[model samples]
Target chain A: MTATLTPAPEKAPRRARASSGASRRRDSGPLERQQSRLFWPFVAPALLVYGLLFLAPIAYAAWTSLYRWDGMGEMEWQGLKNYWILWNDPNFASSIVNTLKILVIGGVITFLCSFLLTLVLREMRAKLFARSVLFFPNLVNAMVFGAVAGFLFSPDGPVNAVLGWVGVETPPKWLGTDNVFTLIMATLIWTATGYYTTIIMAAVDQIPPYLYEAAELEGASAWQRLRHVTIPLAWDVITVCAVLWTVSSVKVFELILLFGGSNAAEPPMQTWTTAVYVYASVFPTGSVPKLGLASAAALVSLVMVGLFTVLLRRLMRRDPIRY
Target chain B: MRGPKIVAAGVMAALALAACGGSPSENGSAEGGGKGEFTYWSMWRADEPQAKVIKAAIDRFQAETGTKVKVEWQGRDIKVKIGPAIAAGKAPDLWDNAADVVSTTVVTGQAADLSSVFDSQVPGEGKKVSELIDTKLVDTLPKDPSGSTKWLVPYELISTGWFYNAADKDLAEQPKTWDELIKLCDALKAKDKPCLASDGELMWENFLTLDLLLVRDNGAGTLAKIFEDKSGAGWDAPGVLESAKRMEQLVKGGYLIKGYDASKYPAQQTNWAQGKAAFLSNGSWVAAEVSTLVGPDWKMGALQIPPTKGGNTEVNVSLIGFSVPKKAENPEPAKRFISYFIKKDNLEKIATEAKNITPRADIPAPAELADVQKQLSSNPVRPVLDNLPREYNQKVLFPAFLEMWHGKISAQEFVAKAKEAHVQYWKTAG
Candidate 1:
């Protein structure tokens, strides 16, 4: 019995070796192993959700654009007629102009304010307190902020009241007239500065303290440090933010809807961005449903957004900087 | 690692559990199945006492039918909720909406055909709907320019006219003619009170008032021709131009409240309610809204805008209504509910709760609505606003009227612009 047990123990090593060899063969190459194990495990679920929720819907919208559908009836194929109509539509042209204005003017204003705010926050002695205070507006929802902002700039609101106290007889209507682009841009700046500042501040903070010291030793002023050291180091983050802001600003609806200040359909038609125009086409004032036209409008807007994203990406190409 | 993975697994399990638990009634059946429960969504807010009344009615209905009912308050913004549901094929079984909305809802096939339901429930079962609602108004619904009855059904009837303070003895009692109304404005102006306080943001209301003036002066057929032909040549008609000229005079005469261009409907209404202005053009619904602005002590009266020749003639009424979806899950139940809800007793209940006028001719007018009914009954009820095509309403008419009101363009210029816009709208819309 002792001899048999000893033989069994000796054979266990051989069996273990054989099993280990087979397992190694199963997991031979890094790429094949990753495909079998890590790739599907890490990526499949997210890809499935994204494809189902977003990509599929976008694909469907693209398909729908080729047809004239009134939402409830049988869809009729219209080929490129809808697109042809959109090309000549004045509202579509105005929407494009308005979107670009928001992107360029609003983008520049937000970027400058955010960068300045970050610098101010970083240089402040009470950094934590200052940063918290600066970042507070980011916590408030945009819709709520829009309401509060509207009240502040209303004809008889506190801003005008303050202007009254200052003995300025005529205060321009912030919400009225056709110059709503200015008001919208100002709102965008006010809303986005804090959030972008936080993002930029993180990028700014990641830079080594020694870089600034080196700049100082090289006889650089504060301005020079920002221009030469800070900005260059934060270029990647700034570009990313710009790209994000461009996409988001094009899709802005709630603020314009709420504070575009009634008589929404007519003049100051220039105030309507693509997103607002699309929304209005879908759900116009009063009670006329134009579902087919609205769907067509949405398709046009998607194309515009896609074209814009590609153009922006091409224009804003920058090497990723290692800090 | 094993412990953390177990915690992550537990979290995922919890999320999965929550998701599974969320869809308890996807099949539209109420829990317990002892009694059938139906859900009703309304534009009324939860805080409104009317919502409570609606809930009470639901409860009463449930008790009578041995089915449970739930009333959900969706607030005044119906578009946000209803639009999506209509798109998704899950719209509410019953809803309250303006008559204009019914036109679009019907055209899009979102509204259920209630012809049979109307026959079974309404008192005048076989009567032509045009006889109940103004036939001319039914003609206004969007069609292929071939005149089709795309939609029909009205729940409430409201008329737009000038409402004035009853206590203000200085204000003339319901100006009978355009000239007399202007004279009244002059008198009010002399008394250091504004003759009219209006919300410019509601460009449509002001335009409707102007349209009514045109109708009264040019005869009712003028606007109908314009809508039918999609031309502004009708706008340049002698009586129509005169009406625009009259509007300009009123604006120049300082009859409107201060900052009229910037003010919204609520603000203008409040201004009138505060007695800052002696008159306001609005619907009968304002009686309730005004009571909230001022106190119950402020007595109110309505008057049809006078005709051009000082005659007690043309009167127009605005109607609001409800429509059922064509693809409703429970069509029979939906029809029964709508029919029950619009019956005389039910109509009175809703009117009392909503503090608005009921459309049913059989029901006696409530005390607050009696004056409006009396004024409107003397003349033919006409749905002026609803009698125009969607494109005319949105593109040509409203924008041009707004420009005219803002003093940016003369009435002639307004007419020219309107004609161009009308042509453009018809090109696509037709």
Candidate 2:
């Protein structure tokens, strides 16, 4: 199973390592020798399940993508025509653009807020409380946040009420049609930052306080210590967080969908992500349900995730700094 | 590990090779005849009186025929559950559903033609089932242009209208003309209140208003042309523009509830129920949607869209019908049950107890919907929103209407843009 489905990232550096490390002699341990004998049966059940459940379906999708099929009917073979339709579809294009905006723009804002919070939270008296409060959003459903945002940002909602009480009377339209997508992004960043901050907080705690002390003794400012000692130490966790954020951003559907609290069966297409696009195409609300189009979109999304993950991993690769 | 992975890869590769040949999906159904326990999937919720009456009928059927007919009260998510089962060829024997059965179930070919059941007599009425129902409904379920089969059997009939609170000893302010309607809105505006509390987020509700506008300007037939016309050239006709101007006036004239576009579904309806707004444009079933909120003595009344300057009142009528799935396990019993259930006495129970309008001509509409029913009976009936193609309604058309509501585009711009979009759609369609 691993031979064909071995993730491209795993294969990539392995090929380069095998080629470059030709002179390095390896010694096999007794446990490694013992493990090789048991590997087949040990992996057999899991491999069977994964292949049948995960990879087989993906392969089936790849096959089905070349056809024009309504789920309960005959599939007319249309090799690459379905992909052409997807490319031409303004909704699909917007979904892709919306997805990237969320991934990159939302990612930047989230990391910025999370890093700042992590830094301030380290010295705060009620650090645990602050962290927990920040962490609470991830535990709550995104739809709940969406609903709350709808209530709080209505024309005469509390946000506007507070703004009116202050000097600035003209509060922006938070739930307006154009503003909703931006609101959804802001919500995503607001919710996601807390989770990442908690993670980075844990990673920061793992660093020996003595390093900070040493840097301080060497006439390093707080910023200097954070840059040289704190960040370098937390680099591995941050990279992991980056990959996690990227995947999560793509998977976002419910929050954007329920944003501004639409009672309509289908939300406006402006806020749709790739996942929503796949769902809307296959199990459509308005148009004919095209499983072929859905399958093709899914394959495209998978390829996107794969490409981004490879790029991220390659860029984040560094020498392990043993503390 | 390598074995399963390689096998998986090889299997997919083999499938890829086979993909070029175009394997046709086989159509098969277990609908030959009836045997064993029969299952039904009703879209009605269990708490509703429709469910109660259906259950009583089912009990009686089981008692008489000694056939176990299991009824499942599937909620609004009935379509969601039905979709996979339809694909897997495990469809239920009977489904009582669809606001528009033609485009949804009929074209998809999931619903079997039920013309054979029309002969079954209403149990005690001594009348044929077909004779009791509205022929418009009988004529409405789209059939194959080449075939004589009817795809759906019409059940309860629902009329669309405006809902208002009558708690203050009845509304003496029923507007019967466009001038009277505008005067009504202006009066409410003078009182610093919104007369019409409609949810613009859901385009169907908004379209109901637009439909009345279209039908009112010219006639039902003219509006139907706009819906049927593929090129969108007919959209710029006088009647449509008049309706768009009316919509523009409604939106730009400060008559709608503030933040109506931003409000969620049912919020506006709820606002009407709470007496926050003066009126809500909705269907006959509006009472049931907000049944829990209204008090025992709560008075709910609906008014048909008043006559336009030149056109007569055209009421939006819909047939809430049942269709036998092609893959039904027990078509015979399902047919018998539908016949038994549609009997005058049984259907009258739906009216008296459940507060619904039956397609059976003898049954009076529930008192709450008397005015709406009166209007529906008086006018030329059309399928809600002229039965516009669902694709255009949901994607292109609804969005255009939404943009206009959002104040992003003007009414003239809406028409021009829609015409352009329609032209683009035809090019794509070709």
Candidate 3:
């Protein structure tokens, strides 16, 4: 019995020796110094950039938000007065609601379309060609795409021409109608889905081939393998993308401005988003500059985006699976 | 990735070199020798005939005065580029823009008070802009209630009215009255043709029509009171309702081009130019655009909207100008340039090249601009959409007018909503 138990004692001594050696190295100044040297070199550039560009501007905006000054005039300290005005501003409220609608509705539509496309591509033998075709729209800039879409959707445009071919007699005004928000959402989805599908496909690719092989060996069906492996593996990236979409959709302006020529000015109240509202409010088309109010509005928008980001991240949180 | 990196490096190098010596400020200083160069911005490009004429004058002035001038030509979207520069404290000394944008510029305090410059220069320029530019139009500029000029100098005067295809000489010669215009529309319609083509998206054109109708029906004074004074009761006046009723009748009669409600500027103008429509209501700018659609040989003529019963004489002029930024690095040079540019000789050149009438009374009118001149020289010189308070012009008036054009809202409903919006704007603004 003593001889049998003594076989494990040899292994334990070797493990202890290895642990002691590791502890000694950790205690040595040279190893710690080397580790810090390697870490700082990697982090320095990123830290410098963040500090100079993002952090500095955000900090300045916060400071400026507390002042009551026209951008050109002398600064007057106003504490929370600007913020108070923003709370009371009806335009600000409308913008917030509009932005949320676009984000939620547009994001859902985009995600569904991209998700289905990704699955179809993943299953198909012509995946490479199909993926390339789907990704083509993403290569065009949003401004250029918005202009082209405007032409296509205009009253005497191709859409109407097609309707005429079918003898519809009267085609619905796609862009000129008061309910332009629907058109805007449709455009956002059309422009965004291709790029997002590609991203989702890449995420799906990361699901281990071994897992699929194992499932197949176990006689698991294609849908069953996808449910078990693909969804779970790619869920994290998809969630991150959703959060990014929320932020981007809220700030969408180029397309709206380009399509809605600066002076059309219909749908008076709801035509603007937070970004457009801030611009219009500060610039206030055909009015004086209200930079202080604009900055305050910007601060309010930042807070809104920050809160949503936090909530979304919390909603997306999950225990990591160790594959 | 390597290509991008190399390109970025080159850009950085270029930027650094630009920062050192190629900056406008440095170039300006060197060229002007401490007197400083004036940076002038205009919504006209070098490719525009107007720009070429103006540039020639600038070259002449520079040669004679030994003052260097730098101009930044802005395209159609003047505000987008100008607004950023203004916010960045890099605005030009002088900027040419429409009267509609004057209020915004003034509020920014970006415009310099040119009272002294005006007093000294404009009188001697032999144009007497104060007389040539309708006083009612000048009053439209953003100002303190106490009578302080804030932004803009009255520059290019434009007349807004109906432009008709000379190929359809019958419709062009007739329609001297509101009734005649309606009859003309009906006559065209009877022949299976559309009488009018309008860019529904351009709210100002619609607003211009309403203004013209008001002047034609009630008198110019009533029209002035409605816009210049916030007299809301005027909307209930017979002239206002009559104009609205006429517009509604036109809509119902199918006199407007098919799908005119959703048609774009180019499309509507193109229709008129192609002789598919008998009439296009727009400002003097149409001549240049129309030139592109129909050759110069296809005659185009401007005509004031036909008058209504008990109406005053119809008069229309485009209200446009240039302003000096208060924070401009070289205000003196800007003032000098404004004076120099608006001289009789320069104005004549601009009128000839642009194919539009100059506001200068002394400038010899170009033969090509005779059609526009005839329209401008008509009685009552009404300023198109210039008299509305800035807020109303932008927020309430334009949108409400657009709704009427879209046929989504009735004229009566538009008037009611517009009044409400105007009151609300004033309340908030006050």
Candidate 4:
């Protein structure tokens, strides 16, 4: 036992020597040169795939956005006129406004609710089970939610049926054309909060319990501990969640398209988002498709999401704290 | 170094293989691989009655002609996919849809001109297909966007009108004019029953009423002219304001069903079928769509949209039929199939089994469409909205009309908004 305790004194110098050897190897040429030599071999496959599948389509879209083509006809050189046309289009303007509303308003509400849920579930006995229950909505397809919401909010649907039973003579027109976009935003928040809360809960689980107990000993309230420790410690995950929400919100198409639950090819124009505008423009029901206009609209959305992601990352950037 | 070099070679080979992967299958599926085989993509789903009828016909045609047909039941979204397919030179040799949709293919120069098919005789029927079909419907077949070629060979016709439950003998007296129609609605309202039940969110369905009013008050092609006028000067046409005012009166007069503004498709139509409303302004196909809901109290009846001054009393018709793509590998087999498809025995299935109005005048219309067929025979037919571009109708006209119908604006305000929006629409259309 005495010899085992004394081995630490002998092990310290060996550890120091091992670290010095590692640093010496880093200072030398062989390891770095080997990594450089292997770099292309390791990266070339992924680079080729990414360039072909992702960047190439984006480039093609940008190129086509300049010409007025009907997908099967002669290409007319419209240059920047397509963009100018979109700028003047009132419907396209409405789509852009709707996209931004989903990004900002929907994002804020989702994150706030997710954080609150995460905080509550952190102390729960069945935290794992509770987290799973909260995340169940994400597992369900969005189309189901749209169809169910359409049924629930119909004038004589079950929601109103319940209201009637409760003696509420006049229920709000929940599926009214003016109310559709707001309802869509609510559905999005409802579906998204659960997924994000689970992610935040996972991040919170990594936090050592001793920190909370230490804060408790220091007379810190739950809110103050969260404000000081939980947020900062989980800041990276929250940043990632923000980026995910921004991209998904801009691409919110199927929900808006199917919200009213009719087989009608197009939804009401009042509820169009940028993605819906792109789809409807490209594949209008009974008119010649507008490929050029649709390409421009799609690129506009891509650029918007890219900008949002970058801005979010920048704003949420913080130095990572070590354990 | 050797290991890295080998890995690089492997990566390049993999990329090269990946690039080559998309070519083989694409080339293999090329058309005209066999003279006896031709591909067809239908606008109907596999399980629909129309598809079943057509499939039975296809089997019969194959047995008789020794031609093999490979068919894909692409359903309605085929419109969205067909363009790309045509662009890629992977389109089916034969396809069918509503005439207006086929005209879109014609507009894109994808649909082959079928005048020869029209001149060709219906197999064993001893009559030119064109001669057998309704002349008015053929005359109104929508031309391409350039207004040159006719592409659609119509087999079925669907017309727009006011549908009612004919079981009520008192409702048998159809209104002959706009005023009488309003009086009928007013009487129904007095009885605390709704007059007209429409799917307000369905722009095309609601558009039928406005288009009829516009065509009646002004003339045929007036709505088309309104869209074609790049300067938006056509909004100043008196018929435009008159039609707006009439629609406004329908809105303000409490004649429409409650919550009609928010009604999704088939909701109010169901209500109409149940006799909750006196009438529904809808397509003739409403009978077929709601056939399951028909009870003894409900007998489908249709009335021509009441005529107005200078309306020309023209009937609005939509033709659903077949077309051969310009890029088709075997146009002959497709053409042969189309002719066989229209044989008297074969074409009647559209009416008997599918519950639609057949394009052939020789075939009797379905019982539900007796009144529509009678009207079609008597009146000169015109394409829906005088063949207006659907985008213009959906975007510029629908917004103003919806606002008015929702009681958010008056007819005067409708005219103002429509004019302003019409001008804005054309400003950048170029």
Candidate 5:
């Protein structure tokens, strides 16, 4: 999400230099001048809308984080004490660790699977149909997955009943606290890999078919072709995908919240991400709402997303490869 | 082509800007109503039995008082909406919720004192609303900031206990002590039946065994005090430690139904109703919730947590009650309606149609809840956990017990971790 901010600075200087070169030539046409004249008028509305709808809420959240308000009473100045509470909170610490696990561990597995799927898929007939089949899960609501998992993995549900039929009397508890996160990560990867694969495959399609033909003619293996051609060609899309995953992984809430169909109360602390932490703090059942504490947690997550987005962009920056 | 595309883009941007500038219309307006009416937001959905009972009462209340009542059937999480509404100075004239939730969400500033409503006589009962309900149950309602003025007038009561199939003659014998309870578990397990069924993901359902153990053994408010202790040393109390040890026994003894620790809400409890298990530790509402699952052959019965030495015998109760917000434009009519609500005719539906316990001791309970109702009558009542702070309950207390329940740690380890969390909480919370 923070990638939206990084591109503007990089593009501004290049645009300025091009316009300066055009001015030096004194060759600007009536069309170019008119377009320039319309630019501000065209863009002003979008900028204003973005400022009000997007940036203003973030600023308001930052301001609210410094006060101790429960949404009902007078706002008492809490300053940074709310953040201090979060820093000391063991639950909050685990929540951050869980968020990072989704970003790093889940990211690696998902990207690797997506790349492999994209490569094999690029060589196949009916690849479009296969890609659509793979992407089907992305269209389903997350609550459906959570509910299906509860049914499939219930103690005496189908999974265990099948194991019992096989004479394996004791199946591991799939939704146990020790195992729930692994299941969640696996589900996330299963649903996400297809999306990344589709995007990378779209970029891969733009590469000349002769590039692969030429590689194969020179005795290049599939792995060598993928390494030398496919990845380099699709690097731009992959970079965007990584940044998308980072932001999304940090914001993973509904799957974990409704995991195991346990929405009657808060989900297990073991499954909480930063998003879940913010939500639980604000709308806790049988407890007072802590808007200030929730705002602090939310700001911390926003900063994490910003830092990670910038880091990913810098690491992935490369000279554009022309076909 | 270029000019048209640019115009289209500009129009889209303008439309987006217009969309951003529009604000949500104020909804469920609580004031500026016709003179004879007031607004109420309820914590029950329109289709729920509780809502039906209340709807009936509203019709009767309107007929008797000639005052109109507008109700919005906000579901269980009504507090989420009520918080912002109260903050915006648009709170409904009256609302109802669990005492602890109402205290934290509305009573802090918005709840009007309802002590006067308590003293006013009911139309046909020839008694004040306060006189109708047990004084013990009345004391459990949330009060104003002054600590002496009452704010909530409760109509329904919920208490937790072990619910079982009364038709199971072999399980008819109730355990009088914790050891006997374990013996019964052993007997059931020998017959290939689990003694208890509990959902692991719902932290409160899992925590109930410990909560009841601590409260029933030491007294009500024991768990609350342990949570309030800033030093985190409260876990060292004999009652607290002993409760943990008892929970450890349930885990080690394998008394919980297979996969109880991994099942979801209504799953394990449904299993209990299906006769896969002999007992379910849950609130009184479980009978109503799983009534469909249990066939005609099955009958529901409840047993209190077995008492211990020096234990308080009083029931630990939670009240779901009505409160008039302080900014209410028609507090008198709302209060008057509440008095009518507790009348014998209206309150009886809570027990009959809703399958819940009514706070009015004069009203008989549903057949399934007679034991729970009898306990409420015979014993004085105290609020559960004395209304423990939500942060501590959810963040610190629940995880500690959860780890123990998952069998990753022993009872001693549970106490140690809980104590550490308590100390860390205060260090930052201070």
Candidate 6:
């Protein structure tokens, strides 16, 4: 190892001393040549794998969307017909609406709760423990929440029992067709707010304590210090968090599926998101699956995520505060 | 840098191994066709009573033939787990599922042709396997619409309709007609109890109510025609609107137990068993599902809602059957097991141990379901709405029917929406 390494350094000096004009003008090191030779070998395997598993499958789904197929049998060319059907489908349209509700409405409520909690938790003892408790739901499988929601909200469940104890005889039906989606959105926000708060708090902690001290010295007040010093420094992270929530919210399925009951055939159409729509289109109980429509719905969801991500980054972009 | 390079190489090796499907998923197959090791995937969970009886049967088969049969209890996730495996051609030698298998396996075609298995006689039955099973189930076994080829060995039949508490001594004898059923439901309502306790979220439970009404008002032929006629005409057949109206009357009259629409399934069943409500619309499986909850001697009875105005006794029946994957390497034993399964004695063991009905005609119905079973048997069997295009019942009829039951739509509106959904489904699924 030493001999080979010595030759590269030694050759560089001798070549520099012996060379005239052209050769001396260009000093190409052996190490640089070695690195160039090894680059593709280092990168090609990961690139090939990513292409096969991710890119190829995505491309195949896109191509498959052009045909009417049942995950089996002959593929009939439907061209734009599947997408046309999706456009006219009230259920699909409603599903997209539900996805947006969870994305935009659920996002707002989750971040609002998170930012409030972060402000208080920063100064509190056992703040780390509270953060862990808040983030615990993410560790459990989401279907557990769905199943628990079913039992908790049942007419004779503990939630109603509490209401009864409070002398409210007629509690609103929490799992009714009208209210189940609202409960789902609420549950998503509660479970998700902790995770983003943890991230935002970490970014806020990275902001210099001196910045807050200076603001306090100038009598900027708590609200103004938060508005100017803390938020600006955390703007870049908040953008990433928005993109993360947008992607995750649209993919919500298990909670909604099990919210009404752990074993209902499917969640009511009133609660469906694009993810649920895609799954039901492909594997609806007792019906012939529509794979082409499933692919189209999936592609639409991908477009939604892509569009939101770009918008989030654009809107949240700022001149970096280097404090 | 060296550490990252090592990690990258490790990941590359892992991906390559995964791409190659490391170590072939070999389920043992017979070498020359005598008896060999094979695998069976059952939908029953390990703790289920059916699992024990099935495992005992497998043990008996293994002891007799020296075959090492691997039994995997997959519960409901059996399909979800083995669906892709079957497509990848790694399905077990013997898997029990049907109908849902059609689009993925029976047609495309991943399932073995079981017509010959049907031809194979049940031991000591003195008839072909087809004759021993309920004729309705045999007829209802889904065939490739493109052509006729039997793909399932019909085994268990669960009769669908309403269940009543035998414990309610004041409960009168079964109604003889649709008007009588309405009278009975309303009479129960007058006494502050509804005639039927239902889980409205389960669309099929409500759809079954419509099916029995349709059958009594229009014979089985109307249903068969309904399947053939994709136009709104099929959904709007002569008696269809009237039956929906009759059902709408019961819904409007508040004859169903209060809060039916909000109740989830099994919760409704459990409530019925608990005697919180008088009657439940469910399948024969209700007895076995809530047997413990109702108490051993508590005794429950089933009654199919009677026909309308001296109408015929046509009733709905569903079949639970077995099928083999085309990729199964040991069809010989799988075929043998299918035959072995139908012997009146082995079936009786399943009935006695699992406490569920088997398809053999010779066996009397289990005590809980005996009344409904007799009603189901008195006439020729017909498929339940489950046999309809799943989209028709699930997407079209279900939502529409549920809305009407919720009193959100009129029976006339349900008919219109069902027709529109039918048109849309035919246009796309075609």
lDDT of candidate 2? 0.73
Judging by DockQ against the true structure, name the best candidate: 5
Candidate 6 similarity to native, TM-score = 0.86
- Residue pairs with colliding backbones in model 4 are none
Stretch of 10 with least lDDT, candidate 6 chain A: A1-10
Candidate 6 structure quality by residue, lDDT tens digits, B1-430: 1111222223233333433442223533324323676778987898988788778778887887787787889887765545445544457778775455443466566677888888888666777887787556666655664465477776667787677777676475667767777777777778887777877777767778788778778876565577567675788776888888988898898887766666555566777777777777777777777878885556677777676756557667766667787767677788878887788777776678777777776877678877766776787677776377665565567777878887788989988887887676666555
- A best-first ranking of the candidates according to their TM-score comes to 5, 4, 2, 6, 3, 1
How do all the candidates rank in terms of lDDT, highest first? Answer: 4, 5, 2, 6, 3, 1
TM-score of chain B of each: 0.79, 0.85, 0.80, 0.91, 0.90, 0.87
| Residue-by-residue lDDT tens digits, candidate 4, A78-157 | 99988999999999999889989999999999999997887788787988888888889999999998878766777788
Better of 1 and 4 by DockQ: 4
lDDT of 6 by residue, A201-313 (tens): 99988988888889889999677777877777887788789988887887787687777533427777778888788777765655555767777778777777778878776
The DockQ scores of all candidates, in the order shown, are 0.09, 0.25, 0.18, 0.27, 0.35, 0.16
**Which candidate would rank higher by DockQ, 3 or 6?**
3
| lDDT tens digits, residue span B1-430, model 5 | 1111222223223333433432222333332564578888999999999999999999978887789998999998787777766666567888999887788754457678888988999888799887887777767655567774377888899987889998897688888888889999999989989999887767776677788788766777787678767777777887788888999999999988888777766678888889999988888888888888898988788887787664576676899999888766677788888888988989899999998999987788999899899887887677766677666777678878888998889999999998987887778663
Give TM per candidate.
0.82, 0.88, 0.82, 0.91, 0.92, 0.86
lDDT of 4: 0.80
Residue B335, candidate 5: alpha-carbon lDDT: 87
Model 3 chain A: weakest 10-residue lDDT segment is A261-270
Off by over 4 Å in 1: A1-41, A179-181, A261-270, A284-288, B1-93, B109-153, B230-238, B310-313, B328-339, B361-368, B389-392
Candidate 1 residue B18 Cα shift, in angstroms, is 24
Which window of 10 residues has the lowest lDDT sum in candidate 5 chain B? B1-10
Summed backbone clashes in each candidate are 5, 3, 6, 0, 1, 4
Of the pair 3 and 5, which is ahead by lDDT? 5
Candidate fnat values, all: 0.10, 0.12, 0.21, 0.36, 0.41, 0.14
RMSD list, candidates in order: 11.8, 5.8, 8.1, 7.8, 5.9, 8.5
Q: Candidate 3 regions off by >4 Å?
A: A1-48, A63-70, A74-90, A213-226, A262-270, B1-37, B74-91, B107-110, B115-155, B217-242, B295-297, B328-330, B362-369, B387-391
The value of fnat for model 3 is: 0.21
As for DockQ, the candidate ahead, 2 or 4, is 4
